[model samples]
Target: MSSCHKCWHCITKRTRKDATRIVDVKQTKELSSPGAVEVDSPIGLLASTTAAFLGRARRGPLNTPVFIENFSEFRDHFGGCWSGSMLADAVQQFFSHGGTNLYVVRIANNARGARIDLPGPNGPLVLEAAEPSSTEHVRAAVDYDGIEDEKGQYFNLTLQRLAPDSSIVLDQEIYRRLSCQSDNVLFVGSELARSQLAHVCNTVPAHRPDSTGAGYINQTEMGTDGSALSDYDLIGSPELGTGMFSLNKIEEFDLLYIAPSMTSCVPGPAAVLAAEIYCRRRGTMLILDPPETWMSTSDALEGFEEAGYAHPDVLSYFPRAMSSHSATREESIAIGGAIAGLLCKLDRQSGPWEDLDQQGFELSHDLLPALDIPASEAHRLVKGGLNVIVGQRPGHAMVCGSVTLAHGSQSGDQFTSLTTRRLCLSIKNAVDSVTRRTVFKLNTAAVKEHIVADVRKYMDELVNAGALKNDRFSVDCDTNQGEKRINCTRDITISLTFDPACSDETIKLNICQAKSDSEVASQYA
Candidate 1:
């Protein structure tokens, strides 16, 4: 009996040690290569260059996504990242609320702008703004006395983007000892290419412009902000990669926000649908601002019907949050940016699992819900899949509901839960990361078994961590016996199922009272 007890003890200890080793190995693998669960995604913003005025710099590739760090970068490339531009304002809101990463896509129409002249031995050299902005003003000076090389081809050049008064230099660049000759050491092309203010044009000048130190050279033509961006502008060309499609250049993003711009046009129905499709394809969520026309709940409902949006991947805030414009005291600005910022904050702190409603999130500026929605209207709005911003004061502002613009099944209460949808996305993304590794391998049972094992491992971890209800997930990768094998389609089909972790938003309390002792005695008798 003593020997048997000792043997049992040793076996139990060995099992425990083996379990710990397995757990340690799993954790180390997860840390070394962070799967979708560990990596936080960035948000993508597609708007007009007017939203990000980069002084004299021409806008980025018409449809390319430009990664920006903060308001300074937005201002450096687009102009003022905020101010009156709705897109800029939304970006500010996103950051204030707690978003860390931002990718900006600056769109323009008919890219044209001003040109400045410089003196060159070959002819007249022309300099143009790197980006198009009506507010941009460039002034250059030739330092005839500052020629560094004995070649006499080297001279100093200074450029500036000046204020309206021409006194304050908004931005400036200086190139010393540059030569017009292509063979020269500091060729003009290479030197001026580094200039953020302007670039040397390819055309050779017939004659050099005046080198007067008293006044600076000015631009010949001003740029236009162009007409309001159409759906095509927001949808962008997949081939050219301009507009929202530019986000494809990146591997993944957390959110897609398309706010109005100085152009005054919000995304139309077509643009909204395109954004939904793109978000769905990329595993990102869309944060849509309300149309200016949605002044009332009825208006919003009517518009929602017209748009016919029913995807679970899109969320729209209503009536547009309003705040005092930073530039102008009396004018009220849109609150879309503030809401985006708050959502980012929520995502960072809690991993997008909590409902953004009733958490007491506040907007940066003195922003409030645009309309005073009555109880009935607010209910109607939420039922129709529009999230509402509600609060009496600025700091008190709070998002009232967790909902999306999706209708029918997507509009169902279970599917309407943003937390549930976000969890679903996280699971899908994580599963994708694991299964993608199995691609291009032999289509044998061993491959399928390994795929299933990886998926089950992940799902098991989620269950242990309380992210899933139980070990009830199913992952089937059996493709060898089907038509796929016969046709050599190189197809691997994977099906997954699991119940997501959820929270109880509402609880009911039942109350009852017992009959008096005297009545109970009488009834018994």
Candidate 2:
């Protein structure tokens, strides 16, 4: 497709100014032929060939130069070929070359393997295979306290570590198992867990001096004999009172077995709040095992509502109206958990959260009827009309304004006037849908043409009544978008004095345009 000069030429040209020797040979024969032979070894050709081979090899697998930092050693061992061992060697070499992190791909085959050794200073180290089938499994193995035995039952409180050699095997198994599931599980975590779990699982097969021929099936019985459960089997954070209080990490397991002596130390309200927030943000499910009571129904409902509404950016565009219903504290907590999970699932099913927000706004017009609010009001509320009373002290408070709308139309003819009315109604409906209220009426054509004149008259009336000392208001209109739309903008200020015992006063303003004889309201439904 496209060709460019090689780096060698550039480097040579740049260095020639500081160096003594500079030659431009058109052909290899000029330097190597009998009459002008400069050197006999052809070392440059060998170096060029080697460099070219290395360049091609780099792109062929992984495409990471760090992976093959020990190129000579790798070439000698795997001969620069593409193989699992070659990849492994490359990875190891990469790490050896001060590369601390890397991801390895393990293909399922008879020869596939990984080597691991406990961190140490000595050269000789013990190595073994890591066998894990999924990220969940890997997490369980790494975080939980046991292993699945030959009998398909988990041995709780067991301590285990994966051997380096088995790391790749575990990674491959984990990838294979999880690749079949649609859930968004982290691959790296899954592989690591799988390897550790496999190691623990294989402990019985490997046999230890402490093993009583009875095996893991009888390990529980040993616990009754005053043996420490943690010593013989593995248990996750929950059993140890350190598990996630809101969502259990081990809920991913199909069948979880806990020791009779195990006790759950559920999280507190703060934990529940954090978990709910995390789940809501991630759009994933957090399964809590040995469920614990956290926030009461009222507290949960209040918290969710407060949180939901406070973030207008999110609530304004949320596709569904969020509400809570709980008869009991437990039920409320359960509902809260469910809501968190459902939101995450919905988010994933739809798309990214931001995309969902945009799409939600587009679909929100249909939800006004269910909310028992006018479509226009709902639209305005969402655009920013309604403000949640966060901390309203006696005379002072905070309030936010809603989205503003301004439009103008030309009276071309009967048909054109009718079209303008319909458009205005549409705007009204959209605003009503967001605010859940209606607050405007259409004005006569004579009044519409001179809105500023009417405002001035109102201000004069207020001043004459001693209700206004100084009128401060502004109005302006513009024709833009190729003069197809006229935008009317306005700002108003009013001051009032009320009786000492009366609560704060709020005034409502309604504005509309007059309609021609041909204008008619169209059915919004």
Candidate 3:
């Protein structure tokens, strides 16, 4: 448990990253950064970057999940891990595209941690950063101010995590009244066990560490950021919680975009399959980027059909978005971030049921599609269940097509439209939220009625907001659908099946109450 004191600097030409005692350097008081929007259960990402700690720790008693609150805070901590890291660009694309509800998992190959050695009465005292990084500017200071220790064996320690290229502190922690003896009540080892910054590397010295904040101190040693990520790095072990599996920490996610593992606009086939299955398990959508082989419209169509890349819970966009590297050259980048953000904006501004077919749904950042698609090609791509970028004006482009990878389902074309899937997810989220609060109540007639009434009110709200058909949805609770009695005494479970607007098939969802243990709550009927 550490204090999250943020300064919220503008990050413009004149601002810096600082807050609290360290932020007094910049004197920033309020948060007014543009594109800093807030929403619940935002889009999740798997990024390759360096940090004080990327929150991708091994399973143990001291495991901490790094849940990002907003875009600005993400920039402050993961803005610059190493020189070539894409943490900033990926997040900025999401912002420019208008997505929220973010969770990040930092990955490394053979990374090493930064540490500092201090002078102690008996031996040397060592403290190391929680996560490995070559570019994280971290340091520590020791002070013995007003200690209640009668033997003068207590001292204060301050750890500061600075920006990648500046002196502005991004995170700072102060541990006071810590004793050097292992048997003491306030032992340094036990005190720093809950620290978010650094941990005691070795056993505490026999006596208190000397004061190093005033005089010259042996500063922290720089560690290596290791090499680029591999395919297995992204699809980490499910049990250990690495790579895409790290998302187990987040309860609910609306959209997911897996950044490139090897090169631009591509992840391994095995990784894509793993992510699709994982997204299905979590009851969400995966925004896939075009494979490197799809350089043109005809190629994309042929490649998408030939490859076994069709799933109801997975959606994709075509060609790529041309990002300006300079005034002269523009490189083709994947549209996963932009497409995810556009969907997020659509889900918020319009209803999740509303697709970005028309009505001024535009992509920001002077972006243009990589290949020009004629009307005939666009129609064919839409039939193949892939979206496209159209209207290549200079400053921006339009998200013209909205289709899911699902060509057709057994019940008809309900999952064909991306909006239909989103609408169903929104309803699922609403049910889970309401049922969680009602789960602990006794099972009575009034309680069951109250549950049904709450769900119906939610469905009606979606209808009022132009998200659902007028009379196409229904809710059933505490009743047996099959032989099983809809049984749950200590747990809460709700089974639902409804039709989306202008859809032929019914959407079936069996959502269990969300728990903090990363339990599988949603299943297909």
By TM-score, how accurate is candidate 2?
Answer: 0.18
Better of 2 and 3 by TM-score: 3
Q: What lDDT does candidate 2 reach at residue 209?
A: 21
Q: What residue runs in model 2 are displaced by over 4 Å at the alpha carbon?
A: 1-217, 220-269, 272-333, 336-525
Error of 3 at 15 (Å): 12
Cα lDDT computed for each candidate against the true fold: 0.58, 0.22, 0.61
* Tens-digit lDDT track of model 3 for 1-525: 232123211122212232221111111122234323212232111111111112222111122234443566665545432234444455566767666545556676667667788887787788877667666556777887766668988787777766666777666767666778788777888877766566788877888888886643434587666666666776788778677776666555667776663335366678778987887776678878887557777888778777677887888878677753335323576667667667777766766777686555677647777777898988888888878887666545777666788884442466778878767666665566335544334444555676677677666766666665565776777532344323333344576667666455667766664222322233443
Clashes of each: 21, 52, 3
TM-score of predicted structure 1: 0.69
- The superposed Cα distance between candidate 2 and the true structure at residue 235, in angstroms, equals 18
TM-scores of the models, in the given order?
A: 0.69, 0.18, 0.77
Candidates ranked, most accurate by lDDT first: 3, 1, 2
Candidate 3's C-alpha runs over 4 A off are 1-71, 80-83, 143-153, 163-171, 216-220, 237-241, 261-265, 301-307, 324-330, 408-413, 480-497, 502-520
Clashes of 1: 21
